[model samples]
Target: MNTPSNRPAKGKNRAKLDPVYDLETRERALALVSHGRSLNSVSKQTGISRAAIRQWQVRIEPISRTSKCSRPDDLATYSYLLGLYLGDGCLSRHPRGGYVLRIACADAWPGLITACRDAILRVRPANSVYLVPKQGCVMVTGHSRHWPCLFPQHGPGKKHERHIALEPWQQQIVDAHPWELIRGLIHSDGCRITNWTTRMVNGERKRYEYPRYFFTNASDDIVRLYTDTLDSLGVEWRTARQSRRAQNVSVARRASVALMDAHVGPKY
Candidate 1:
């Protein structure tokens, strides 16, 4: 019987081998590349071969091109995302490259979390979306280089501390899909609640229930934008003070609440 030895095979008998990398490793490498780092630099930092990185780039280029070739066709989805962003969304610079957009959704509303994730995908399908759990809320986050381009309202300070205004194109989208925007805003920071009081009716004390919608925000500019849109839709609203610093845009009129019910309703 012939015995095997620790000798290298020659010619056709030699086996070909290639290193395998995990998806997370590949993503990290690509993220560095996306940040405009040189291939040599990334290769040295990531311990990945330049040739392999090049192959990855070529393989993914077509997909990126197809996904980001034009603006999203779903303008309504974009409008809704805009409302969510203005309400509870924030943009932070990514350590690798580009920016990350995060929208806080209450854990109680799983449907809203799903909706927020779906909306982010619709807007930036090429980017990756993540759900991060917090003390009482879930953060819906996505990574993209085009976030600033899409959300021009991003600035140096808090949204309420600075001016918040929409671009003309954004206004056009909001105009076309005003209900979707309102629904998003309501989902983020507004709520529909029932108030009750006892009154004498037919010589008997009866409790009457009143359903109203309240949109509370610290930003005067955001409040103005919301009320302006409501006005355009003929939805009556008034500014009421809930506290010394808290102002709520209240919609208590039967007709207005009916309109809100027909469109926004209550958050899930």
Candidate 2:
């Protein structure tokens, strides 16, 4: 006698279960929902399906939620963090499991390190943020499984060697919070400086000072993104060759410098 195969019969399909989420992720999503976050918002932030979230809402009782981690309601924070990430951050796979987001902050600016840590917590409150010291900088790092969901730009190879483009959702956020993004970019890779020149005025040599902002990056795509955002904000900028490959975006116009001063002052 021939034995029957265990596989599904031809022309008939077997039902498949949805991918299971770990208890931590499940609780985090449910907590967001309990706190009046819409299924859609939580879904986008956590990369969890709305249908699954709804089911959990029905089956589980609401629990007191901690700041452990949830998607940030303030898109400004996310935009700023995005700028920092695009400027000097990297996402790598964790040895234990999940992904780690790390942004290098100069040791000279202790405040920026704190800000970086806070941004990570705000974006994913559940994840733990830590500081790793390097030769001249500190790495503000956070570990979470949902990092890729928030930052789809993560991939293999160096950022400058590859193409970098924002997703539609990220574009929307950047549009709404352009200054925050600029502030972040400046904080990471841009600087405010003063240039001085001697001019003849009233038969005497007078020193004239010009304050400007310069954003330097190696990736053409990133440079374009910075200039495009500046254009939209009415901030005039010009590109100059910082090196054979690196380009420097200069905001030298008086009005543009003033605007940058008001919104994105020198990093502390």
Candidate 3:
């Protein structure tokens, strides 16, 4: 924005022409801001956004190597973003330092990111996490929840019809197996896949999946269901990579085949 002329009425003193704020306030605020104070910090201290302070061209230069990370609101927002970064489904321990979690459900997200950070930090310390801007080449699965927080109170829709299926650790699972998936026993009715509407912040893409299969069964994703329904009747019939044989079955088959190929069968 164009700076309004500091010259008040023609006769006004040049010093008086300055903005009404205390003479030193703007300078100090700008100094701190240029020195790497976060917007939240500058706003709290000077009652002005870092944006406002940066408006003056003189303050545009970087002043410090480390930007301030402490602010009441920032702690929450950063923590949330940080948590989102650590959560599975987006990025993995790729070739580079790490990966970036695409902004999923922005509806509540980014907001939930703030809340999630606390949730994550409660479980893991902040320093343990390293934040980088898109530093990995690992593949990532799309996210599940409506953006923001996943708390039941912040459920996807007001009706609360469906629960978010994306687990926070799915990315790790994907990384663990690379391109395989393991399951207890997929006894589906020969049909697998779900057509649920994905709640993506960006609406340009969609993938309809059913009969979820992964390259690795010993994954954290598998653990999700395993932990949720661990108790089993001793008579239960199942096949796992670990199982040497299935009763009355010929040769043991590997579920390592790609999901699409599984339905298509070995022949064309």
- Candidate lDDT scores, in order, read 0.86, 0.85, 0.32
Q: What is the lDDT of candidate 2?
A: 0.85
Give one digit per residue, the lDDT tens place, for model 3 in 1-268.
4345643455557547545644235545655655666767777866765555656435434422223223223233332333233223233222211222332222222333333334334423432322222423222222221223322112333211333343444434433432122121121001123334554557666654433222212234333432232122111223333332211111122342243344222210
Model 2, 1-268: lDDT tens digits are 4447665554435224457776667766876776677889988988888988888767664422421334468799999999999899999975434678999999998888998889888887766899999999999999886788788889999888998999898899999999999999998998888999999989999999999999998888888999999999999988755786688999999999999999999888
**Shift in Å, residue 117, candidate 1:** 1.0
When summed lDDT is taken over every stretch of 10 residues in candidate 1, the lowest stretch is 62-71
What's the lDDT of the predicted structure labeled candidate 1?
A: 0.86
TM-score list, all predictions = 0.77, 0.74, 0.21
Off by over 4 Å in 2: 1-71
lDDT, residue 235, candidate 3: 15
Strongest candidate by lDDT: 1
lDDT of 3 at 262: 44
* Model 3: number of backbone collisions: 27
Better of 1 and 2 by TM-score: 1
- Candidate numbers, best lDDT first, in rank order: 1, 2, 3
Worst 10 residues of 3 by lDDT: 182-191
